[model samples]
Target: MNEREVLSNYVYQIVASLVASGVEQVVVSPGSRSTPLAYAFASTKELTLHRQVDERAAGFYALGLAKATAKPVVLLCTSGTAGANYYPAIVEAKYARVPLIVLTADRPHELREVGAPQTINQVRLYGENVKWSAEFPIPDEAPQTLPYIERHTVRAVTIATTAPFGPVHLNIPFREPLVIDFKTQLQRVSFVKSFTNDLTPSKQTLAEFTSIIEQTKNGIIIVGELPLGTDTKALWNFVRELKWPVMIESLSNLRTEVPEDCQVFAITTYDALMKNERFKRNVRPQTVIRFGAQPISKFLMQFIAQSNPLHYIVIDEDPMFRDSTHSSTHFIHALPGEWLSEIEISHVETELAYIEFWKTADLLAADAIAKYGQTANDEGAYVQLMLESLHEGTDIFVSSSMPIRDIDTFLPVLNNDIQVFANRGTNGIDGVTSTALGFSNGRANRKTYLLIGDLAFLHDANAFVASRYQDCDLTVIVLNNDGGGIFSYLPQAKVEAHYEELFGTPTALAFEQVATMYDMEYVKVTSKEQFLATITSEKQQSLKLIEVFTNREENVKEHRALWTRINEVIEQWLDML
Candidate 1:
């Protein structure tokens, strides 16, 4: 067989194997070294290929896609720094438990450390962020490296798609003999099942956990971030029926059936209460029931530590350190849905006044949210309006910093069906745009919205270069307070003007320039009126950039003013009683 035929067959075999192994979306970054692999992925009809120029953005884009789909996303890049560019997303995938399969093409070992163009250490470049890492040797016609490639690809994808799922690395070192023909038929191989089957906990494990829950009173259930399709409704019903003081994280998806009696504090909102003596004493339950991923709050962590609950039950399939509560008593290695079904709801006695205490606190919070709504310029009001305008089942990828916090605090989820995602594990602004783009890959049938900040969007501007979201009805609403709006609410802002220059770091880039560059539909709104009008408008074929402009300093003042008013109202209401 000709050399091109051999390589083409190799390509066909690789792509077919990936498709058979359940890899759906493959993100390909353009480069000469990766031409064969790119063509292989794009040529196949079974797989979807999202073409991106910037490798860094492409990597995060794949991360976002995998996160939303709960499937393994394949990332293809050429030799050199292209592979290195994926490191950040790889770290996020590992920490966030998203499945990412990285395929990096490299020159043979002979080309390494010898002034070779676009070449570096491709071996284990991702550090501890990858679940598994392997390098495929140069294929020789006789006993070809096809078997090795197939085995590693299968294992990497399997590990990434299973529980505690994470990113995996595969480096293919090819020589001059790497060229392939288009028409050659490559030999195929069966995909090996590499999933971990020990997900079912033993009977003894269930009994031990049941004993803890039965004996514990004054317990609190803290649900953090959960995986997609993990059956949150069943868990929500169980917690509600149990009448436990459950602290629901925004990403937990446990906010759907929240009871109106108000034992649930909406802890993400009243962050300042963590420091208040009366607030802590009144709201801190004796135990905590944690059942999701890590939350986005340092104040809550401190509160958990200081309040020091008697016990904290973290029920999750994966045993991860969910928080710094420093009091995880029971790590139930079973799915929340599984565990909740076995236990029946029962009445437990604590400080009997605890329920009423939280009830008063919830009323205080509701009143504060209502009053804060009057000021349409603040972060809370912005979140309220944005969420109210969105429809059910809209996939929203929230940027980590302030946008997520504000949503957690002020926005009442209009629809429980609206899927929400964020790079919460790393919580960095970089690649947020790319991540959203990656998530738009297979969503031609659905609408995807991105709630981001001005700075975060600017951080990954290159992501909009060539978007595949044109058919996906994608919209990006950028809250342009010009900088880190959330930082103004932090203690650093109290230090004076230095806060603006050092921490907030406001910028004045026009969103129109970016929209024009991408040939996307754009709208700039300076008030709530324009925002609502644009949000309610019909969805378009092109991606839409809705920029809401506000002053950073003023936004901060507004947030602080709202908090002060909340404290005052809560105090006066208590006095009336």
Candidate 2:
């Protein structure tokens, strides 16, 4: 076989192995050096190929697919800065434990540091962010080249999907003639290697955990952002058996899935309730057991730091120190499902008074929010209405900054199975729209909703192009305060001279024009009734943009006023306690 034939066969083997390893989605960014692998992936009958023009958006797009599917999604890009664009997504995948297989095309050894057109350091490009990284050799006519490529391809897929799942990078270098002729029929190869890891804790460790649970009288369960594909039912049962007050994060998936009847112990509005200094001081637990990552609520973090419990145990699959407050007394490295399933908890005869106190506090907070939401004309009220209007099983992607914080603070106790997602891994607003679209594409059966701010919407406007081409079932709710609304809550809002220019940074772009340019169905709602009517109408099968305009000053004021009301309600409840 000629050198071109060898390169073609190598690319074919890699793609086939990936398919056999159960990667069904591949996102390819257009480039010359990656032509061979991209064409090979496109030719494969079992693979779904998604084409994207921007590498940064493409990376997050693939991240969303993997997040939704709980499988590895392949990412293909050309050499040079094209590979660098994948860094943000890789970091997210690492922290969020999403599986991704990143394939970047590169120049051969001779082309390195010699002023090649699209050449840079491609080896270990992502640094410590990736789970594994490697540089593949340029395909040659040697007999063993194809087998080596096939084996490594399977290995990369396995690593990406294993425990502590994350992105794995494979820098593939190709020589000249990076295209394959149709006349050369490629041979199919089978890879039969498999990897498995069992991270079940020891019997002694489970006994120790059970002892810890039984000894504590007043304990709290803090649920953070759970890994994708986690058994929410198992989590609910575990919390129910413990009979402890459960503070669930909005993205934890537990908050939306738990039945209202079972939510007596579930504190869904802790973010708002903890803001009351009296409530924070009185609601203290003797023991604290945390699961998953740190929560999105800064108030909860501060509360944990201030109310340091005697036994603060953190249960995580990975051994990383996810505790930012440094208050954890013990870090138990174990899968939450496995640990909860194996450990035997004898019914502890602890007082139900503590749990009842939390339930009362949560109810009072909800009542306060309802009172304010009836007349408040601000972003918090808008988020509450939007969340209540979503149908069961809706996949909602919340953008960072104001949208996520608003939902955490004001969203009501949901009876439906609404799945919430966000790019909280790195918490940047660069690819919010594209990531939501990718998630919508992965979960095509469910209606998807993206709650994003104006600045975040504009930051990822190119994602609308991808959405238009893919025709995802998505409703983009743009909370347009015309600028960075979240900045008003920060200390910089006090700076009168440069607040507008430096922090506010208002952009007067009309999103209706943007919607028209992207051919999306557009609606501008000014009142709460109009907004409710729009979301409750017949769901669209194509992309739609709904804009709700709010004033930054009014939004900030409304939030402060709502919190003040919540404090008053809490004080009343405390008097009864």
Candidate 3:
């Protein structure tokens, strides 16, 4: 067989193996070196190929797809810096435990060190960011090479999707004359059977954990950012069965639609209520069973760090360490869903006052925050109003920093069905729009909206060039605060000398023109009522951008004032105690 035949056969089997391993989506960024890989992936009938011009956006695009579908999505890019562009997404995927298969096409081995054009040391380009990285041997005419390629490709998918799931890199170095026979058929496609094992805690482990739970009524449960489609019902059932008040962060979709009777058990306002120093110091629990990644609230983390619960058990499906407080006394190696559904956690009812104490405090904080939002006009009320009015079953992708924090504070607890997503893994603001766009693309039928800030929206302006969302229903609510609104809440705001130029990096871009350039309908949101009426009136099938102007300093003052009011409510309750 000639070079074209060998290349076609090898690439065909690679794509074929990926398909057999349950990969239905492939995100490809075009380049010359990756011709063979791109052509083969495009040729495959079973795979839905998504093309993105920006490698960075493409990587996160795949990340969002993997996140939404809960499956491994393949990412293909060219050699050199094209592979490097995937670093941010890989970091997020690794830390977030999203499954992604990264494939970077490189020059042949001899051309790597010799500085061939478009060639660099693509081997281990992503380094430890990926779960596995391999330098694939150049395509060969030998019959045995087919089996090696097939098995290696399959193994990559398995490693990425397994527990502690993450991205995997396969660097393919191709010689001159990249494969051109797009119609070349595969000699053989083989698939090996594989099974997964759930890391369930043993009887002794569960008994010991349950013993701690039964020992005290003041036990707490914290469920952080879990992967999409986790068995939230089972986890909620498990928490409620224990009768322990649970703190579910915004990223954890389980916080929605809590029954009226069970609403008291859901602690959704720790960010505001924990602001009261007295409540923070007084409301100490005996045990803290945390599931999934670290909770997003800084106040909550500080509370846990200072309070020092007796037994801090971190229950996670991933074996990786996510104990942000670093005070975990027990580490249960079990998925929250699997353990909650599989194991029988005995009903350990607590003193009526214990649950009522938390219930009252939560109700007070929520009421105070809601009342403040009624009169306040800032990013908080903007986010609060929009989220509250979202159509049920809307998938809203939230950006990092102030947007998520505000949502954390103002997110309505009962009868809410909106699923929130964010790139909180590494928590960098880059690619915020792209990930949301990919998420929109993944669930195209669902009414999707992106809640982003000014800087984050501009940071990924390149995201539009790489996406085909011009026709998609992606309602982007760009909060044009002019700068980093979250920075105003930090102490650096006191550094009047350099805060504006340094921390307050504002992008005063005309988003009306930006929307036009990006093929989106621009709507300037003037009032909360107009905004609510616009979003809820009629749903459009095209991309829409709703721009809301705000002041950075005003947003901070608004949030602090609301927290102050919530603290007042909290302290009044404590005074009665």
Candidate 4:
């Protein structure tokens, strides 16, 4: 076989192995060096190819697709800075545990350090962010080359989807004639690798855990960021059996999954009520059990640190240190669903005083939030209204800064079937719009909603390119505070000298123009009633945006006032107790 034949067969085997290993979607960025891969992926009948112009946007798009589908999505890009653009998404996939297979095309071995155009050190480019990295040899007719390519591709897919799943990088080097012209019969390769492992806990460990739970009268369960397709039913059963107060994060998906009758144990307003020292003193958990990633609420973290529970247990499948407060006393290396399923809990009769206290406090906080809804221009109230108005089985993608914080703090106890997602791994505000669009593409049947702040929406404006081409339903709600509204809540707001110039970076671009340029329906609402009507309207297009304008300073005041009202309600409840 000639060099071209060898290269063609190698590329064909790689794509075939990926398909055989169950990779359904591939996001490709146009580039010269990646011509072989682009054509191979396009020609494959089993793979769905998505073309993206911007490499950065493509990276997050693939990440979102993988996240939504709970499968490994392939990413193809050219060499040089194009591959580097995937760094943000790779970092997020690393911590967020999304499965992605990143393939970057590169020059041959002889071109290293020769000042060749578009040539850079692409070996192990993502470094620690990727679970594994490999440099592929130039395609040749060696006797063992085909087997090596097939095995490598299979291993990459397996590792990417294994326990503590994450992104994997494979740098492919191609010589001249990057394109494939002749049609050749592709060879079939078998994927014989097994990546599944049973993580059943030992009997002693379960007995010890049962003892801990039995001994503790006042305990709390904090649920944080969970991976896609997590067995939320198992978690709900475990928490229900424990019969403790549960503080669920917005991304936990448990916040909305909690049944209506169980609202007494579900503490959705802990962020507001934790600010009251009197409430904290009256209802602090003696033992705290946490699951999944770090919580998004800063107040919750502070509360955990200050409480200094006797037993702070963290259960995670990954080995990473998810505790930012460094307060975890025991770390259980086990899958949450598997562990909870194995442990058998019997009914235990204990004093109902502690649980009743937390239930009363939660009710008081819920009442406080209900009263706050009478005021307009409040972001927290808007979040509550938005969530309440969403239809069952809606998918909401929240931006990192204030939008996610608001949802975390004030989102009510919902019984609707809703899934909330965010890029909380690194928590940067870039590529949010693209990620949401990709998620919509993956789950084409679901109606998607993206709640983004003005700055984040503007930063990822280019994401509209994909939205224009892809046929998906997305309702984008832009919270336009005219500046970095989150900065006003920080301590730097007191720095009256340069706060506006430095932290409050305001942009004057009209979002209606953006909507026009992107061929989206735009509606600017000045009142809460209009905002609710616009969001809940049935006349939304393929891509629609609703812009809500508010004052940054007033937002800060509203948050403070909401907290004060919550404190008063809690104090009143305590007086009755």
lDDT of 2 by residue, 1-577 (tens): 8767787788888888898788999999999999899888888878898988899999989888888888899999999999999888889889889999999999989999999898999899999999998888888878888888888988999988877888999999998888885454445656776958666667887788788889988889999888777777767778767888898888888777776657788887788888888887777788898988899988888988889898899988787858999999988776667457656788675578878888888988888887776889998889989877788989889999999998777666677888789999888898888888889899998988999999999998888767644666789999999899999999888879888988899998769888888778899989899999999998554878999988999999999998888888888878886
Model 4: how far residue 247 lies from native, Å = 0.8
Q: Please write out the lDDT profile of model 1 over residues 438-544, one tens digit for every residue.
A: 77665555678888999999999889865643333469989888778777767897888688788888776779988888877999888888888998898564689
* Candidate 1: worst-modelled 10 consecutive residues by lDDT: 261-270
Winner of 1 and 2 under lDDT: 2
- Name the lDDT value of residue 373 in candidate 2: 67
Per-residue alpha-carbon lDDT of model 4 for 550-571, expressed as tens digits?
7888899999888888888888
Residue pairs clashing in model 2 are none
Clashes per prediction? 6, 0, 0, 0
The Cα local distance difference test for each model comes to 0.74, 0.86, 0.82, 0.85
- How many clashing pairs in candidate 2? 0
* Global CA lDDT computed for model 1: 0.74
Ranking by lDDT: 2, 4, 3, 1
Q: Candidate 3 regions off by >4 Å?
A: 342-349, 468-471, 539-541
Off by over 4 Å in 1: 257-275, 344-353, 413-416, 468-472, 573-577
What is candidate 3's local distance difference test score? 0.82
